[model samples]
Target: MVRARMSPRVRQLALIGLLLAGIGLVVIGIIDPGAPAVADVQPPAQPGTAKLAPHLFEGPDGPETLPLDGAFIANVWLQGCQDCMPSFEAWKRLYEAGEIPKSLPIVNIAYGEVDPAWAERYALHDTLLVDSDGSKLVKPQAITTFTTLVVAADRKIVWRGLPRDPGYLDQLKSALAALPKD
Candidate 1:
């Protein structure tokens, strides 16, 4: 058997190559983290009219309608969607940082039957609208992607897209800032 040892220069080159490869992987992962397992539904086109169906959610107060009289943030998600985690984190951070207004409503719509315990475990504490069968609100919205829509008081979608996108968040901030104070 023959034993071979690489020169110091060769070993350093190999180590540097591995380090570069690792950094590249990290960068790629950060740039496009991709989406969660999305439902097989078609999203409505951009600038489409948006309206919250009457009595869409049954809250503690009773059957409720989404307030269309002010700018609000609506996050649409499905149960067990792994990709929604980033969106959740982004919103949480924004909330903690006070980037999201305390007065502005953060509406979370669960597209399917979600356990109350599941929500508690996930810390989905918001004004939740449960669309357990996708009949009332989900189907009507034609929601597809894991989306966060900034809706104006007039039922116009001012900004619509992923909640985790940095650019989207910036756009959201700008849109919210432009909304007339109630």
Candidate 2:
């Protein structure tokens, strides 16, 4: 009796198929299936303001804290992204334009580890916080790479990056305008 062995080409093809399957699984695991469609706008949470959990900013260094009231601009970023630098640049433009409220704070949330000083310099003085809400705990809530949220006092997202990619500064303007003059 002779045993048939897979030819070299056949073996290579089988290996490639396995590799592709592994990659697919990785993609699925990272992306959320139940996320809301990008086309729909995020309604502002109202009646009561809910705090973004310290875990969201919790880190080995310390937990990042954000103001509970007023409009806020949070720049969500992944550490490796070369493009994320623009979000920081945009903040500068808004500050120079006087579009950003002087009193309100700017929160920069990095998806992975980042240089504290660099993030600060890039933020142009805005508060920088690492996203301690790593994949281990954080469930991706259906947002884009450059996703920015204008959180109302009630802790609900009043407006998000849509109808136009307003970048950072423009969003700051919209948030400022929405804030009441006390």
Evaluated with lDDT, which candidate comes out highest? 1
Residues 87-156, model 1: lDDT tens digits: 7677667666766655588777777766656655544557767776666656656775467777777766
lDDT of 2 by residue, 58-108 (tens): 444676566565656566665545555565566556556676666656666
Candidate whose TM-score is highest: 1
Root mean square deviation (Cα) for candidate 1: 11.0
Give each model a TM-score: 0.63, 0.56
Native-vs-model 2 lDDT?
A: 0.56
For candidate 1, give the lDDT of residue 20: 100
| Model 1, global lDDT | 0.69
The 0-to-1 C-alpha lDDT of every candidate, in the order given, reads: 0.69, 0.56
